[model samples]
Target: MAEKDQVAARARAVTERFQFGPWSMMTVKSHILKSEGPTRERFESQLELPQVPEMIFADNVLRVIHDDGYGIEFNALDALKCVDAHHDPLKVAVSQAWREARSSCEHINDVVKPFDWTFTTDYKGTLLEKEDKKITVSETTERIDIEKLKVREKILFYEDMLLFEDELADNGTSLLNVRMRVMPSGFFILLRFFMRVDNVMIRVNDTRLHYQAGKNYMLREFSTKDDQVKEIKASQHLFTDPNEIANHLTLRKEVFEKLQFPETPPEEGS
Candidate 1:
């Protein structure tokens, strides 16, 4: 009972802005696919999402929904290990799924959306130090290495999640979207999906994740029920295409048809 209570307590403790900031990061490399004939070249501008989630665990998976009605299933383990090699027991304990509200999400552009903001955080770890009789070091030494310590990234895509207020968005939104290409030197590929937000708080197992696009949107307890930072539901969530998140998958029209072709029969058959 005590262990279970501790687990639950730790789970509840995971809600703060940057709960698992100290854990190591596993980099994720995503392959992409595109269907539209307009092959896009040139490196698109990258926007530094203020914070990206730092805690994605082993064997855990997340289904991402973008505004374009596209959905992608993210294997937290593969994304971390394959991309960066995520390996930390504490990360699993502290990190929960995206658990927050789904409101106050701003839009960037009609073609571009932003989401998958882990969060920006700086955490510290400690190591024991030993000293000789002459070197009696009773105090703890502290240091900060911003360069290699924690890595942050922003995940962007186009989504069906509508932006009612045009004033809140502009053309700048397209600059930060995720880029998927076959060749590093050839052409860059752009895929459409949902989840355009400024920041997101995700708890691995929880569903009510909070995400907001564009920095500094309205955030109030009343914005969502139960005082969650964001509210998440099917109606408000934008989907992402899983194939798009994976760089290996080609975004061929036939591929799209295979993944999401409706049951509608051909006119001739009807």
Candidate 2:
């Protein structure tokens, strides 16, 4: 038993030496850890493989919050080469946290779009006679005073769509989700038409990545609720699937008049 313990310790020492703490920190790291488990144990943070490419890591603080919620930080000095995670146990912890932060930001877009609408209707003054609908013509011949028209301002929003990529974690798939917040620049407008998204869409390299709307991911209330990623959708090639690719068949707007409002939008007119 003593010899065995010595061997193990020696091996660990060799491994640590292999990981060059003396070397320096790496510029950037990134990754996506998808999960399909329960909410409590969902997506395990993953170290961004060399691919995700986060330039910010080169000049930013890497922070990791364990399950306990205590934050652990990794400093990035000018010589960050000391960050070889191969043999360093702490390296994995620190790298995973930074990677998750960067990767998790991908869903900031679809999740933050419009939600509801409010505005004053163009109503003529109330009178004894029934209100007659005014037809909106191309151009009115008579000059109308702008002051006379009722100025009813309204805000509009819709249920947001939380967007994410398909990947696997030990617990479940991690679905990147975000809520729409007011644009700081347009504070006066509030949640009105002046809204601007602080975060943009994550560039999904391949739409061929197969993910079912309800199965792989679900969003009941994008702003206040969490989304569940049920499965890891297999990436499929749309070009090879003749039947699947036909949905994009373009049709003229005139042909779609029979379709309902939400079900189908009129194709753009020529």
Candidate 3:
């Protein structure tokens, strides 16, 4: 008990000393005695690995927990490596974390441009009117002004969140909007995307990827309305197949890499 306490205390000190931005201090616990049973097997099968990646837990295999409830099990040296990867410790914790994503805003823009395709948003409003001693409810949609569309992007260092937002105006009034937020960590990222496709259609996606653990989950909500008629639906999905995870991870790595860096090489260290 005394030795465990000492190790945990020391680990906490390291995280607190160097942690930055939305990264809060972490709690550390020894995981040396825990059995690698069903969890290990499941992880391997989900990743479809002929053999599990090497598991090297030094004298003290530790479980480190972040403020957002995400955690990982690894050794002290490995833990520090994660922290050094541009403040994204998970990069070292999970090999796949270092890879880039397959698709991104740039890709979408490029593809659509070549095809002469563009996206638009609509605004919907409801009104109640009296007619012949009866009350009638009606909905109206108006197209937003393209010439006045606004776009903005920002990054939140403290919360590890990235945001991209767009808005359009109709007759000097707000008509349509879209917002996207990305919260990323060592093992996965939470992507929250919502868009009002004009007043007639709305789409929302909450996607969470546990690539390291091979747990991929997504929640989708969509609604469409035409004057008096409307349709809405929502669904969720989880995927753990190893092959699928690999493919998704590969594509994700590609897209993300393009966002962070360019193909051109940098000059030698300054």
Candidate 4:
């Protein structure tokens, strides 16, 4: 119990929280990186990857809680879980190269499992369960009003946090991060995972959430875009920036959902 308390205390030191309408949003940023610790061990075991990313902020998380007890969160562990554990045909070339280079290494007996080395994940977010207040989700025809978000409004709060990142064995880079902004009208969040494999391909997975103030539900969208490296006609410098890389890739898939909050209040002391 003492050790657990200490760990929670440490996490609290780097976490920040704010309230917007009926929702409470929190962001955590930690400095701990790749190290031999319980956090790293748990990440490896759960992810079941040959190796974890170069930089995994296991303690970092972005969470939103509703006053009625419903909650949703984005974290490194859950995001990584969405990564493809089996060999992906799109990344076979890089995987083969990696294996060939390591074949002559000292750890010849160590088996290297074939998996997506880029660590691309399509995770939108994880939902939190509250005693009896259920949050139901379904496919929605309604989409987030991007034009409304463009309108000028008083910014109440804002935060951007990195969940995890990797150098992709120096072949390129893989990263995931989330950013949220609160306005007088509502709140919007973007969780993005971007990857660049030199001379191979570029991929971007984006999850957008929009909650209008006083609304009964929240809107969520997930999108994926990718293209062969040779197809993109842009300055090499732009490829290095995740924010800019998405613009060059082609949209591959999209899914929109609505999370409906329970309308009725709980019974008293049932």
Candidate 5:
């Protein structure tokens, strides 16, 4: 009884609105499919949604509908994981999914439309520190090699917003960190990508996009540490063309692939 009450209280807290620097922010977490248009029919007809199991965990799933026709459709058992385990498994999974989605969106222009996909990240930096003090300086330097270093990533969600972070480091120094956030309802995306080497900024690309009713425009501010910042304005038509919808679907596939967890460095003699 106490657990149930606690979870109910938590749900309220998570759904409540909070003040943010003279603005009010809603924290309602939604799991419904969303698109930038006047109606949900437009989104449904244009996009292909993933087929979630109807009977998850050998039982029927549950749907929670909101007044605005958006809601979370999830397994009752899985939903109970939040209260039973005292942690939000669903939130973690949703965040991971959105992270992949944003990655796909980032690469969409390259694969679908004509655009450059080059990333200007400096590799000459220390990212992780050595634990062993007895190790020689040369050994430490070798351990901090950029190509040999692996990229680390994490995804987190706050209500309706999702944040994805991809970082690469040399030794203990930050080489690059790209942080992206996505809002499902508003079709909004924000990205802050930065690269540094030896504490010197190498490149930065800060971008934000909000898809309006008929047309969508993205603003990108690009810069190098020593160079002046440059702005790029890109726009696209929403929901009017079939080709655009197909391109968006391809982007989703690209991002959704990450959730499948592809094997890294396939084994020999397969």
Candidate 6:
């Protein structure tokens, strides 16, 4: 009973929910991280990666559900699964030095596996569908209206959650985070994985979702920006903030898709 109560208490402390138009959103942010025990072991086993991040919020999650029974969720487990565990194409001299330094640390060498130490992921999020009501996602030329998002509106709800992060053995930083905002007009979400390998390279993978009020569809855009450290002319201070550094990198890839939802019936009360 005590353990069950404690679990319930922790769940209550970390979760928040809100309803915006036809969508319901929830966010979870847990304590720093529990490095040992079942959770950590499970994460490591499923990840199959050489090394875990220095700081991982394994319980963090961002989920959105629509009235039509369609949903999408962002969680550390799913995001990490998208990371390349077999290769490290972005490796460079600095990466090698960092790896060597990490190997020399106590207990580090024993668990080290051959994988991308940077922890870069192109995860967009996981989509969910009700067995009775399925939604279709297809490539679309329609673009998200950036100008519309800038319009003044009443902010309804907002939250930010960090999935995981690593300092790269003091060489640089790698982290994944998600942020969401709700307005009277609609809601928007951004899931970003950013990496900085000191004196080597910087990369940013971003997934943006936008949905308008009363709309039957939502827009999702995935983009990647990367560049060698020497190629970017931005001030060093920008590197501290992922959003700031992202502006300086060059876009390397982009994809756009639309999620079409089925018409949902009105609530009984309405």
| Per-prediction TM-score | 0.16, 0.15, 0.20, 0.87, 0.20, 0.87
Q: Ten residues in a row with the worst lDDT in model 6?
A: 261-270
For candidate 5, lDDT tens digit of each residue in 67-134? 22222222222222212122222224244532343354433323432211122222211111223211
Tell me the tens digit of each residue's lDDT in model 1 across 188-238.
122222222223321111011122232111111100011111433322222
**Model 2 lDDT, full chain set:** 0.20
Q: For residues 1-270, write the lDDT of model 6, one tens digit per residue.
A: 258856864875578999886788988888655677765787789887877788988778898998777899999888888888887666453465455555544434455455777888999999988987766777888899999999988889999889999887676789999999999889999999999877778899999999998787789999999887878889998977788989999999999988777664322321
lDDT of 3 by residue, 97-198 (tens): 112211222432343212101111111111112232211212212222223222332322212222222331210111121222222322223333333323
Q: In candidate 5, which residue ranges exceed 4 Å CA deviation?
A: 1-185, 214-270
Q: Could you give the C-alpha RMSD of every candidate to the true structure, in order shown?
A: 26.1, 26.2, 24.8, 5.0, 24.4, 5.1
Q: What is candidate 4's local distance difference test score?
A: 0.80
Every candidate's lDDT = 0.22, 0.20, 0.25, 0.80, 0.25, 0.82
Where is the poorest 10-residue window by lDDT in model 4? 100-109
lDDT of 5 at 68: 28
Candidate 4 lDDT by residue in tens digits, 196-244 = 8776778899999999998888899999998777788888889888788
Tell me the number of clashing residue pairs for each predicted model.
Answer: 60, 30, 21, 0, 9, 0
- In model 4, what are the clashing residue pairs, if there are any? none
Weakest lDDT window of 10 consecutive positions for candidate 2:
187-196
The Cα error of candidate 6 at residue 38, in Å, is: 1.3
